[model samples]
Target: MNYLDRKYQATMSVHQLSILLQYSNQDVFQLGNFVPLTALSLPTIIRAAKALVETGFLISNEKDLTELSVLTLNTSFNSKRINVKVALPQSSKPQEKEAEATCNTLMQDRKYYMECTIVRIMKARKVMKHNLLVEEVLKQTQSRFFPDVQFIKKNIEALIDKLYIQRTDQNDEYEYIS
Candidate 1:
């Protein structure tokens, strides 16, 4: 008897049966030709047992009925294994779209603020006294939309360190180095 023939009397859909077997929560049943039906629910055990019996792989005795059964493999076995397919469920939350919109808005706001500050600094550079003081720069840069003097000072220092602007004498009361 072939593996399929010995395991099943009828031509069962190996793929479907394999899937059902794989997901079954019970642990008493083992894979391969012989599998126990005791771990399965009554309906499933009955159906599976009936299927096996119909396929000629199993025989039930009149006495000592058992929920589990064992199958004998035949030498004519040809199939290696069966494959079961399952699909993944989709996500229900729309967080990705919301996050994207928030990120875009923040980026646009940052770009507008940076552009305004750059323009203000450039305009101030032209008329700034030859001796430019940090205080003077801070005052000139201050605006209703951007009043954080400390933040402005830190940004200017970073720009100087990066060579975008030059800083001369740190001790000088007033100086220019761009």
Candidate 2:
């Protein structure tokens, strides 16, 4: 007796719809009027009535109905199958992956910029103190981004690893390799 039952969706039983329609009889009637006619609970009948209201089978005095809410059959409405197309939302996983890749690329570019600044400063000075070199690198890279001293120090170590510079006997200074 299920009228419009679909998998994973709500439905109104045909018997419940018919009882409500038969009782309306071209005049407004309260939902409670059908409670005594059917073995179903009053709340169950109300739910069916609400489903019918959504399908244009019934017109109600209130959009949100209660047991005392008045309803009338929508006699003018033609009973026809409606084709509803629901559009599913796009997945966010791809977007999250793309954002993560972009962030990693930006970090790599920042690291490159810091290393370049270190090499450029060392090449120009030939020899410089560690703290002074760090300050100069910060000054040169500030127009693009403000790099921390720890990050500058890491880049300096990378330059030393690449043979672009070397730590002096002073231990607090660096000497350009070329």
Candidate 3:
């Protein structure tokens, strides 16, 4: 299993947590079945440390030189790790409301197009390598929309130009782009 799965399954005792916070050597000590703290396993330590902070036990003295040194050493050991920080974007109330409205409109339009018959046909034939002959594609289109072949062809061409479908030749066999 991955680190995330292991973390989810972790259940440490209060004594183990206290050891981690109180002893300097505890920085490298094994806690339960956790992996040893090393260059390759630093993220696990960082995650556990953050969990301690979340539970109000691991307070940092941001202005302390010793704290800065520890942080610098930890960062150097885990150079490739990423820390996820989520923050809401700063925007005026009206601008935030407008953005939400625009997102809703786009989502609704996407849902409408997904239910359209033409989209279904395109989705069904997404893996064809060559252009499907007009006659062959028309038979499938007929079952869905009952439109004339020419009309279906025009609609297919428009969809292709709009990047919804990919057409490889003069004939109408098409594939969905997504």
**What is the lDDT, from 0 to 100, of the residue 44 in candidate 1?**
39
Alpha-carbon error at 22 in model 3, in Å? Answer: 98
Q: Tell me the deviation in Å of residue 162 in model 3.
A: 1.7
Model with the higher lDDT, candidate 1 or 2: 2
Give residue 53's error in model 2 in angstroms. Answer: 22
lDDT at 98, model 1: 71
Ranking 1 against 3 by lDDT, winner: 3
lDDT of 2 by residue, 106-145 (tens): 9899999888888888889999999899889878889998
Q: Global lDDT for candidate 2? A: 0.74
Model 2 worst lDDT window (10 residues): 1-10
What do the candidate models score in CA lDDT, each in turn? 0.43, 0.74, 0.45
Model 3 per-residue lDDT at 37: 30
* lDDT, residue 76, candidate 1: 42
Per-residue lDDT tens digits for candidate 3, residues 1-178, read 0223121222454432433434444433233223333322433444544454333333533432121223211211221223322122233776789899999997555434432546666677664543344445556545544445565556666677778778656453566788
Error of 1 at 70 (Å): 42
The TM-scores of all predictions, comma-separated, are: 0.27, 0.50, 0.27
Highest-scoring model, lDDT: 2
Give residue 22's lDDT in candidate 3 (0 to 100): 40
Candidate 1, 21-93: lDDT as tens digits: 4434432332232334234344334455445434433444422224444332223433333331222222335
